[model samples]
Target: MPKTGVLIETENGGVKAINYGLLTAAMGNKENEVIAFITQNDAAEAKDDLAAYGVSKVVQLKVGSGDINSSPDLCARALAAAVEEFELDHIAGLATAPGRDIFGRLGAILDVPLVSDIQSIDYGAETAVKSHFSGKTMATVKLEGSPVVFTVRPNAVDPVENPVDAETAEFNADVADGPKVTVKEVKASQQDKMELTEAPVIITGGRPIGAPDNYKMLDECAEVLGAAVGASRASVDAGFAPHSMQVGQTGKTVSPNLYIACGVSGAVQHFAGMKTSKVIVAINNDKDAPIFEKCDYGIIGDMFEVVPVLTEVLKASEEK
Candidate 1:
């Protein structure tokens, strides 16, 4: 009856569906007796999707949280209590911004390892998969103790639709002594509203594409694939594309299902952002490009000619 606990985000208009994917990865091949801890902000939005992520139990944590600088550590400690109460084997949270603070506090107090930025979780093996060496490699981490704490990257795992009759319950996740270090003010980024990392399909252009004008072909192909546009650092720095769509070590790391890299040379930094994509298709004139090493399929040709053909084929399929 190996099971785990989930820490769901309910505040700041956060989505709780990511927790389901985290839970699915952590509680693999175990009894369906896991608990999910969510806050008020996301409660309304995250309800139906909890089961879609394979959570068997829902524990909505109520603290005087919402529109206030509530202590994330307090919520984390409360979830720690839930792990003890429900007797779960692991406690998992997201690797997003808020999760960084929550997991940091909980890991220290609980005296357990906090696995962060995990890309996958092997429930049977009790191993957590994380990107390491700045996304150059993947590392599988195992806890040395019980009730392990972990924070996972968003869009890391494919959310499983394993239906379970979940028993929803409310719990007190309030800590007696609040956060040692409190967040006084909030500073939000005023940039492009949409995050390309979370987009289902991402199409990125790299240095090999050569000129700024050539990227339009890549963009056209992206439109054909119904994918968001992305660019490697070289493409962005060379003013071929905007910084917002940059995908690499100094840019947004994406975990899309379908990643089409046109003219990318596959630097370690570039792969850091898109290596997690389920299907990688690389198109380059040079057959020796490093991107070919990790691509599911490769095409040796100029993207200028190849992308147009692909766009036409996709458009024809859509028309049908």
Candidate 2:
């Protein structure tokens, strides 16, 4: 069996939920040996969780001289070393900001082809499927090399449990940190906010949201649903929301399990970003709005009136 190494991402010393989907992708057909590689110090804590998703081995990768989290170049070099040591035939990770940076550097270091933001993968064939042309097209890419390196889009694959008795190991790579660049400090705009790309559910507001404070309605609803709050390009452009919260062709692309769009016109640009959502719900006063055609469910009512009721309903259900 080919040895497939999954670069596991962790938060608060525990494995991130999204990594399970990456594990599912790496498990492909049960024909490959899936190994989970964690750069954090809590691999032991993550072992059982990873094992539940079919990981047979959990490796704690550490650098000799510097912290891997501090230097992307060092992290990539350490991962490369681990690949050589473990005889990894394939390496996969979540296509998050850190994953992209580290995998890009790893590809350069190993001189191997890297396929990024892939939605699906065929491990045996060494092929991956990814979106193109602003999500208008999908392309299947084949990697012709001994070790296939790629990053999967968050939540692209549904996690399937195939429990195994996993073993834990540590790898201390004798690599040097790059002298040029080092991450000084990582700051979050909202520390408690969920990242939009990785969120399974999202509630978005459009231009009709009037002012920034009105986003509180979406926030309350999102809080109840354990979802992320997003804004349309029109809202962002109108200064009602920030660019970081925008979701469109020019903004962040998301593929959530559920998407709620309030007062959003079904523009192609916005649709391109969230067209892959499993279920889309649109709430607008105009029954003839373009969004009604694209959404899976439509609520023809004023968002101001409808959202409060929805929040209360959700709250009541939670209390029940």
Candidate 3:
């Protein structure tokens, strides 16, 4: 069986739920050995969670001098070392911010092809599907070289649980700090917050949301659903929400399990970012809205009326 490695990313000292999907992709019918590579976390602590998703080994890549979070170069070098040491046939991870940084560097160091933001993959065949031209086209790419790198889009694959007994190991790579870059201190703009990309459910507001304060309704609904709140480009441009919350062709792409678009007109740009969501529910007053055609479910009504009732129903379910 071929051995595959997954570079796991953690949040708030716990394993991110998104990594399980990558693990499922790596395992692929239990014909391959799944090894999880972790940095800035304990292998023993993460072993149980990783094993739940079919990981056979949990490796902790450690550095002696500097923190891996601060030094991307060092982190990449360490992953390269692990890739070689474990004889990893393929490497995969979430196409998150840190994964993009480190995996790009690792691919450069190893002189291999690195494919990012893939929608799906056939790990056994070393092929994947990626979006192109603002998601209007999907390109099937074949990875030709050995030990190829693939970064999957978050929530693109549903996670499957296949329990295993994962063994833990420690590998301290000998990597030196680069002269050009060295992180001094880490400052977080948003920590411990539900991010739009990784959240399983997302509720997005559009231009008709009216004002920034109006997002509270969505927030209440999101709180009930354990979801994150997002905004369309129209709402952001109109100053109803910040750019950080924008989701569209010009903003961040997301693939949550469930996406709720409240008062959105269903512009192609906005749909491009979240078309891969498993289920989309659109609430708008216009019966002829374009969103009705794209969404799995549509409600032709005022969001101000529909959203509050939705929130109340969800809240009531929890109380029961």
lDDT leaderboard ranking: 2, 3, 1
Overall lDDT per candidate, in order of appearance: 0.74, 0.90, 0.88
Ranking by TM-score: 2, 3, 1
Which regions of candidate 2 deviate over 4 angstroms? 177-179
Pick the TM-score winner.
2
Per-residue CA lDDT of candidate 1, range 1-320, in tens?
A: 76777777653576544565667765666554566777665443555667656667777676444322366666666767777777878888777667778888788878888888788776656787788887877788886567777887877876766766666777655556646566677766453333576567887788766777776786677767767888889988888877887998999777878888888898888888888888999989998988898789999998878889999999999999
TM-score of 3: 0.95
* Each model's Cα RMSD: 3.9, 1.3, 1.6
Local distance difference test, candidate 2: 0.90
In candidate 3, which residue ranges exceed 4 Å CA deviation? 190-192
In order, how many clashes per candidate? 1, 0, 0
TM-scores for candidates 1 onward, in order: 0.77, 0.97, 0.95
Residue 76, candidate 2: C-alpha displacement in angstroms: 0.9
Model 2 lDDT per residue over 1-320, tens place: 99999899888877899999999998898888999888875888998999999999999898887787888888888899999999999988889988999999988889989998999988667688999988899999996666889899998899999999999999999885453569888887864788899999999999999999999999999999999999999999999988888898999889899999999998999998998888999999999999999889999999999999999999999999
Query: Which whole-number lDDT from 0 to 100 does residue 191 have in model 3?
Result: 32
